[model samples]
Each structure stands twice: as structure tokens, then as C-alpha cells.
Target: MPDNDSIDPTEVARPSSSRRDPEWLRARLDDWLPTVTGSPATITRLEIPSANGMSSETIVLDAAWEDTDHRLVVRVAPTPDSDPVFPTYDLDRQFRLIEHVASTTDVPLPTLYWSEPDPRPLGAPFFLMGRVDGVIPPDVMPYTFGSWLTEVSDDDRRTVAGTTIETLAMIHSAPVPEELLDLPGPGETPLRAHVRRLREFYAWASQGRAGSPLIERGFSWVDEHLPVESDPVLTWGDARIGNIIYQDLSPVAILDWEMAAHGPRELDVAWLIFLHRFFQDLAEMAGLPGLPEFLRRDDVADAYARSSGHEPRDLDFYITYAALIHAVVMYRIQSRAIHFGQAEEPVDTDDMILHRATLEAMLAGAYWAGVR
Candidate 1:
């Protein structure tokens, strides 16, 4: 979840663009579904979720097809006028990536239905998948603040963490298709290439706005401490508990693959760890204990090793890199907010990053000393 330091959690964060009309979408679906399924389809209900993501727009729709009801999710690209977070929205790539992972691995994934590359139907490219019924950790108040995850026993939380790691291991073990390789050119290491991409994204995001000094320093620190390259694998780019759908304390399906890429296993592992820490730190800041013991760095590393037979190495660098990546994302989100008039431009652009202090601590090599 991107940190919104000033925005109230009770207020849902969405782009300032005009809301998509549910009735218009229902009419479009009514026309489009029959062409894809080869059967007449009637959309009974079409709703824009209240908690739609700041990036892609998720549509929850119920329809009658072949005399049976179907509940499905449609992930539509942000309209060009919405000032999308990422520069590009490749729905086709995301759709194929999910399809590939579902076919090649046992990683829990939603049942995929079809991909619509044409933008005419929804005003943007989108893909359809069966909606899995489960509880997702809320990003608004944050599960760490208080949610089902917090109410569960420590043992249940442990089960959630352990099983989630196993699912990540399964994803990493999937065969990397040739199309997924967007690897570095001849002279670059995968880690370096990854950092380079981050730099590029930051450059694009910071244009026409104040740049964050903390983010610049983070890039310098990464350049100074880049680790020896690890073998790249299929990495679930946004690997975190918040992106998962859980049933009875177990992950039933993994959601959100826009960031899926070819990267080191540590990229995924450290991201999972650092994201929890991000939320935990927020919880503690609010005088809440949070799940301090959940998703501990060392515990996650050990569990990944046990599950994958490959020891995670250089996590300090990787974890810091993870924080830096998240900082850049948060910065971009805040920039969008400012553009949409939801936030003011802070005197110090670093203020855009809610975890600026955390990133600084990581860069100073003092963050881990304070953690167990």
C-alpha cells in the first residue's frame, strides 16, 4: 500500500478523474460478453468497488450466462485523463503473465476468463477473471491498525506467513517464458538493471515537480552497495500480504501483477518482509503494537531457504532496496495526489514519502539494529 501521510484513512483514495458510469459499463459488458463467451450474457449487476485501487480500476460484476450466474472481476487500465500512476498500462502483458503462472505453477490464482486488448469496450484494455470470495487485508485503515489479521491467533498469523512464502517459492520456481525475460542488455547485472529501471521511473515521476532528496540519496547508496548478482527468476513484483485474498487464514488467490518482472528471488522475499515492516512501523507510530513478530526478516529468510532450497543472500542491501523502491512509489502517489488537488506540495519534497525517516535509517545502517 502506498503511504498517504496526510490523507485520512476513512476517506478512500482514488484518482480525481470522473467516476466511470456503472450503467454504461453494464451495457458494454452486455454487448462484449457474448462475443467472448460465444453465448448470450446479461449483466445483472455492475459495480465500481468503493475501494478501487489508485492505479488500475477494478470492476465487480455479476452476470447470467448459460442459465447460470457468474461473478467476475474486470481490471481496466486507468483512463489517460486520470493521470495514471505508471507511465504505461500493459493489460495484455499482465493477463498473459497471470495465465502463464497459473498454468505452470501451483500458486493459488483466480480463474482467468479472457483478455480484451481492444480499448473500445471499456474505454481501455482490460481482462476478466473469476472473482474469488475471501477477505483481503484492507489498505485504508491498514490491517496492522486492526483487522481480521490482528484478531487471529499468533499461530494463524504464522500459518499465513509461512504459506504465503511457500506460494512465493512456487512462483519463483515457475519456468520463465522467453517473453518474460526483459533482462538487462549485455553489460548489466540484473540487480543493477533493476535499480536502473527504478531510476528511470523516478526521473519520469519527478518531472515537472520537486524531486525528493532522500530518494536521490537512496539511489546513491544503492549504487555504492549493489550486491553480486543472483540468478534471476520469475518474481511477483508486488509481493505482499495485502495483495492476497485469504480464506480461513490461508491465501486462496494472489492479486495484482502489474509489477511482475524477472528479478532475483530476494527482490520478492525482501519486498514481502519490508512491506510488513512498513505497516508495522506505521502501527507502532500510532501507539499500536501491530504484528511485531509477524514476517520477521530472519524468519522469512530462513523459511524461504527451507521452502526453495536456495539461501537468500544480501538481504540488507535487498531490504534497503525494497524500501527505496517503495519510497519512489509513495513519492509518485503523493505527486498524483498533489496533481489531483488532494494534497498540498510540501516545502520539503521528502515529506511526500511517509517513510522518509525509515529509509534514512536503513541507509544509515541503523534500522536493523533496532529491529529484533
Candidate 2:
């Protein structure tokens, strides 16, 4: 960690204007590793994935210090050179939430070792967690297109899906300690609070470009359809089997807390369902199989009910809200690709966002008219 007096969490930290040159990146890591290990540390292996995560920078490494070896993963806030995916990056909050959840409940998570807010160590605030060996579904090729899950039998698929739901149930059962981490304010339900933050995020992401009318429509529809009540519990914001690390067909570590928050249990439930749908939709567009039958909505809902003893409710509202949030995220991500010179400008701003028809049908009530 950098010296506490040198950095403030609120003051923005930016990386170099261009991606750090190879030599600079290597030298910085060489200098930073020793400070982390309490002695001179030698890197045995290091990898920073090339895939776009739209959240934080993930660094996976193996190192040796003082005759002790360790495998660690560090998640760092983006530098200015690497424009961030969100309006804010609070590594401290994420670290505390994981610690609290790991100690308070049975939810599986990577064992967190250190959280250093001082950016001097690596030019950005970050936390290090022990890396458990497991196979994570790949986002680059996309697990839905072809992966271990596709090769497995339906029985194995059901077992994995059910275990993931049970894990979510355990996470939702965790106690909410507002003092340790941020929570929704008075009079606002968790879902509404989340929506408010997302609106602010859209505003930030929309600057210097023609904003999407679809996003605006989504915001309006979501505001009018707020649920009557929502249970405030820990929500795994990016809940999906893809985020889980599996070994021997069981989740060894539940990863990704950048979107973690206190919200209705239904928020995570809806996300787990809708994220898969988003990918399934992508596969359909390409004319490929995408796990259409596995992780069925009814099966997920039933599994949650049996495990948690509280039936999920108002999924129509929550799932649509999840899609709305995801669409806005897609717009921002497209803008990012433009900034980094990956994709050509689209004819219409809405073209940047995926699943437009699904979002429209959701608002018309046709998407879940009979189900919800």
C-alpha cells in the first residue's frame, strides 16, 4: 500500500495516457512485488487477461518470497490511461464486503489477504486474494457457445446449477452491516437506490456523445414500475455461473464483487437468469446452441425457494430492470471500444447497445405478461 498520507480515495487516480509500455509495466511490477511480500519477491508467473471485463483490471500471478511461495490475484482500479467502466471504483468497500461475507456466512469466496488503498504500490488502489485452482467458464470464447458445461450430461448440468443457486441463497442470508460498507438510504428501497446510482452512471457514460433514446426510455419505464417492497440483503451484483470457479464440478470460489450491494434477494436472482439470456440471445444471433434448456428460469426459482425458504417475487420487475441496467452498460462499453479504437462508429447510437427488442417487449409487458 502507498503511504496513507499520500492518497485519498475520493481524488481520482489516472494511469498514463497510453497503455503503459512493456518496459514500464515490467519495471513497476518488479519494484512493487517486494513491497507486497515484506521481502524481495520473484515473480514466477504473471498474466493480465486481454478480454474486456468493463469493470476492474485483474492480475493473476505466482511469486516466491523468503522461501515461501504464493499464488495470488489482485484486482486494481483503472488508471486514467485505462478509462474506467464505472463512475466510481471503491476497492475498499469491495474488500470489506468480501471479508464480512466470508466471516459471517457460508458463501464460498476467495480468501482475501491484503487490501492496500495506497496507489504507490501499483499506480492504483488494489487488494490481493489467494487464488484457488479451479476452472472458470471462459467469456472470450463464451461458455454458452462451447465449453465443459456443454459436454457434460444433463444430470451434471442440473447439479452445478442447483449448487450455484444454493450458494446465492447463502450469500443473501448474510447480515448487512451498514457501518462496514455502504447501504441504501432511508425511505428508498434497495432496488430504487440501485436504479438511482445507475442513472447517475448513465449520465457520466453519456457525456461527449449522442445519448441513446432507448436508454432514456428504459430509465423512464423502470422509474414508474418500482416494486412495492424489497428485502435488503447482500446482493451479488454480477451473479452468474460464469463468475464462479469450479473444481470437480463444484464452485471453489465465488468471484467478482465490483457490483456487490445491499438489495432485494430478487436482484441477484434476476441477474443470474438475465445474464444467461443475454448470452443465449447472442448465440441465437450467430445460429449456435447456448444452453437453452439448462439453468431454466423455473428451475432456478424453484431451487432458490427450496434452499432459502423464501419464494422469489416480482421477477418481472427485477429481470426487466436487470436488462435495462445491462443495456446502459452496453452503451458505455461500446463508447469505450470507440475510445480505445476497437470498433467503427455505428449509424445510430442505439446500435451500440444489444437486446433492443427484448427491452422494448419487456416494457410492453409481453416478455413476461403471463409468467409474472
Candidate 3:
């Protein structure tokens, strides 16, 4: 089986289980590529990798069609058999959002080719896009944990962080096409929409077992300190440096819009800041040298403000929300681990929230001072 090289930064470090049946995929692409692309479609190289993305599966393939050879990527929705992390997998919405954002903003992204809703051909609804070559900052080992990103100069690191925030500003301030309203709009109250989605995810992730009391506390905090209403715009939900594909020291394409939404500007800003902090804290615990100064909360907020001309607000609330969102994701990862028989259920589920100390400090208002 051929494989596409990728980075899976899982906290638990599970064995690779993503499908890599290249012969099967070759046959499928051989037959299906022509319908979308023109005739003379030939699958030159196909790699159905099992090493990246714990949530959805990505297929990398090169095809020749109509006197042109092209490199492309296919994204498939998570199947029920895979214990998908998020409750929903809207590939069409993801495709449309990428298309919509690319047309209006300067943000770099893959070019779309086709979207398939039927599962009979590949056993999943998938979409195809031109492949953009770059490196993904690893989550498991972490770029801060001695990767190429960490090896770069401090000035280069700062540029990577700065441009990412600038690019995010580009996304937030761009006028979302009215045609996109036909697709998901992140609901009337985007923040509450996020909370409700989280609640649904919590119920699915619990899987008839007990839920996280700490998560409950996190939700309570969110309710108590909900930020004032402001103008909503299209937000890149998974806004973090790790999600950016970097060529040399600059970001080329910002991937992973699975969590994209229309929400307050600060939501994406806080997620970017807090996610870097998340990795930095992990490196500290592991006695590693994470990029502690690269994406500081204050720095990114200021960058967003300066770049987008919109005032950054409620950062404390949103960074804490970012932590909660990540905690929910970690719980889902643990649930998948259990479902895959990776580890036995532990007595204390609180231990599942690896950043319990960080969340507690945030809840107590002691965490922001240290990071800022």
C-alpha cells in the first residue's frame, strides 16, 4: 500500500489506523476522476494514508487528465465505524467555505475540483482539491519539541506567528458572500451555537459513561462571563500555527476548516494564542524548549487588532473557551482510544483533561497573568 507522509500529533500516541488501501483507491480514482475532471484520467500515484488526522481521512493522489498532470488531495468524512470526533462532518460545507473564502480573502488554500456526496464509490463522502506542498507542525512531538520550526531563527519564528495572525485578520474582515448563507452560517448566535455543538459532542463522547465535571465548570464560566454582542464574521475555527502549512518560514496554506464558523473576531484570535500556549505548556511539562514567545496572547491580539482594524475583545473569556474546546477534543480522543482498545478506562476521568491545572488557573483568573 502506498502512503502519503503526514503528521499526527495525538496526545496518547495511538497506532495508525487510517485506511491506506492504495490499490482499492487507485481503482476508485481511476473510475471516478474522469467524471469530474475530463476523460483520459489516469491515477499516476495514490496514497491513502493512515498516519494523519485523528478525525477525518485525507487521500493524496496524482492524476493525469486532458493532457494535464495534476497533484490533488481528497478529504473524506469520518464514518460511523471510525468513532468520529466531532458530531458532524460537513465536507460540502467545508468545500464551499474554502471556495468562498479563497474568492474574497488573500488567505492561501487548495483549489477545489469536485465534491462527492455518495458513499458507494469510496464508502465516504469526499472532496478533491489541488495539493499544496508544505510542512505541518506536528502535534504529538510538537514543532517546539525540536522540529524544523523550532530550529529556525527567532526572527523567522516571529514572522510565522505574525503573518498567521495577519492572515486570520484577512479572513475575519473579508465580506462573506451572501451565497454562503445557503451553506451553514454558524447560526444566529455563533457563540451559543458553538456551546450547543460542544454540548452535543460531550453527550456523544461520554458514550453512556460519566461526563467531565470540570467541563461543566468551564461551561458555567462561559455562561457567567459571556462577552457583549458584536458584529459577526466568518471565523477560522481551528485557528492555530499548527494548522498552517509552512514553506520555508512563511505559511502557504491554512488547512483544517472542519471547525470553521461565523463568530466574534476574538474567538479565532484567542484560539491561535491559546493553542500555542497549549503546546508550550506541554513542552514545559516534558522539559522541552517550546516556542514560548512566538505566539503570545497579547501579541496575537494586538496583531489582529492592527491588521484587521477591529478591536480585540473578551480575550480572557475566549482563551478560556479555547481551552474548553480543546479539552472536549481531548476527551473525544480518549474515547476513540478506548473504542480502539488502546487503553483501559481509568478510575479518574479528570486525569483525561491533561491541562487540568491550566484550566483551573484560567477559571480562577490566575492563568492569564503568567501567559501575558
Q: What's the TM-score of each model vs. the native?
A: 0.96, 0.90, 0.92
lDDT of each: 0.87, 0.77, 0.77
lDDT of 2 by residue, 1-372 (tens): 001232121111222233434445556777877776778988777777553254677777677889988888877777655777787788878899899899999888898978988878678888889988877776646677888888888898888888899999999889886775456679877777889899989999998889999889999998898887656888878898878998878888998888887778899999998877766665555567678877778888999999999898888888899989888887887777777766556787877766766677787887644322
Q: Which candidate tops TM-score?
A: 1
Candidate 3 residue-wise lDDT, 215-274, digit = tens: 889989988988884677887889887677888767788888888876677888889888
Clashing pairs in 2: 14-80, 15-80
Off by over 4 Å in 2: 1-26, 368-372
In model 3, the Cα lDDT at residue 339 comes to: 70
Per residue, candidate 1 scores C-alpha lDDT tens digits across 57-89 of 889988888999989999998877888888887
**What are the clash counts of all predictions, listed in order?**
0, 2, 1
Distance from true position, residue 93, model 2, in Å? 1.7
Per-residue error at 30 for model 3, in Å? 1.4
